[model samples]
Target: MKGTASACGSATVINAIATGEGGAFAIDLRVKSTVSLTGDPSEISGKVGNTEEDPELIEICVEKVLERRGVRDQYGAQIETNTELPIAVGLSSSSAAANATVLATYAALGGEIEPRDAIEIGIESAFNAGTTVTGAFDDAAASYLGGGVVTDNESREILKKIDIDPEWRVLIYLPPGRSYTTEVDVERIEFLGDLVEVARESALEGNVFGAQTVNGLIYSSVLGYDSQPALDALSAGAESSGLTGTGPAIVAVSKEKNVEKIINVWNSKEGRVLKTRPSREGARIENG
Candidate 1:
């Protein structure tokens, strides 16, 4: 059997670590997975095309999905993953990988998975692969569903979905470090629960720009990440700017004519800047 799938990446508007209420928007960055099952069910393997490191997480993802289908002993596969998103940078790379892997594996099994159910399974696979805490339903949902989502992570339910404005350009600033999502200090973030609640309400009220700015500021302060980049983006007239995920990456949105200003400011900061747009498409099977 053979199958393929793809999923997008997202930036944080509100980290779900606080308030259980969080918001995020999908980006054009993506991870793609292809699964080919051979004879030996014990001969499982995986390869990641975008990085130099081992693809252990992809292997674990496939294993977990097979286990979920109660076919752990019935099949073994060679999985290949190609990604444009960076890992361990709070860009939801793991969630995207897991989501794509789950879809590809199930497709290889000739099974149909409901959309949200597939994302939930991907979240479970993340836990099994030791990649996420809090299930990261907010990130997983945005990556799987596309567009923007405001979620109740405690309930694993998306409370609202917003249509993305095509004019909004997404710029991701990649600093020089990596922060693992599962290793974050949740207590430190939760201390700002009351503030996060305010941000959540702001998103609910259609003020995503304000919500993201505040949430990013609060998290950047408590998490020891420099907030200067976001400030610079705002000074350049961005619609919204803030720390995305944990640290080392900042997400800046702009619909104004001053996109060059934002890009120039980031380029001057010594970190890489990736330009992408809002994604309105979610994970789907590419082939079988």
Candidate 2:
């Protein structure tokens, strides 16, 4: 049996460190994973087409879903994933991969699961693979449900979800630095307790731009990122811009008319600029 799933990367508005409240948006870059029965019943082998990423997470994802379903594998598993998003950066590449892997596993097993159950299974895989800190519920949900989502990560509950117009452009400046979720020190981020709380409130109130901007600046300052790229994006007429996760990559929000302005500012920087639109379609099965 074989199954395929397509999921997208997400830019973090909140890191889920200090306050459980967090937000994220689905981007155009997609990660597609296929899971199939393989040669050995007890073995699960996987490959990530992205060279910088480890495929063990994909294996873990399949195992996690199987374990959750209390199923003893009668056949081996093979999983292969291809992604357009940069790996190990602030963008939620891990979450996207996990989401796709989990869904693909379910399909290969001839089973169906609710979207919430699928997300939980994916988060479980993330924990088993050591790829996350807070389980990245916001990121995973945004990738799975598409569009923007505000959530309580600890509770695994979504506080709000909104669809942004596809016409809005998302400009990403990917720098050389790598900020994996596993490397973050939760205590250091928790120090900015009150600021994060205020930011979370802003997100809950539906002020996505303000909330994301505040969260980004706070995280960038604490994580030792330059934060200049984000400021530059704003100077170039971005409606909202800031560090996406912990550091390294900056995500900017702009209308189509202002895309070139944002790209121009990023072009002067050290990293490459990737332009995409926000996605409203969530993760789903792809015909194989």
Looking at candidate 1, the ten consecutive residues that score lowest on lDDT are: 49-58
Clashes of each: 0, 1
Per-residue lDDT tens digits for candidate 1, residues 189-228, read 7888998899899998889888889999999998998999
User: Could you tell me the lDDT of residue 67 within candidate 1?
Assistant: 82
Which residue ranges in model 2 land beyond 4 Å of their true spot?
A: 50-52
Summing lDDT over every window of 10 consecutive residues in candidate 2, give the lowest-scoring window.
67-76
lDDT of candidate 2 at residue 98, scale 0 to 100: 89
User: In model 1, which runs have C-alpha deviations exceeding 4 angstroms?
Assistant: 50-54
| C-alpha lDDT of all candidate models, in order | 0.86, 0.86
Estimate the overall C-alpha local distance difference test score of candidate 2: 0.86
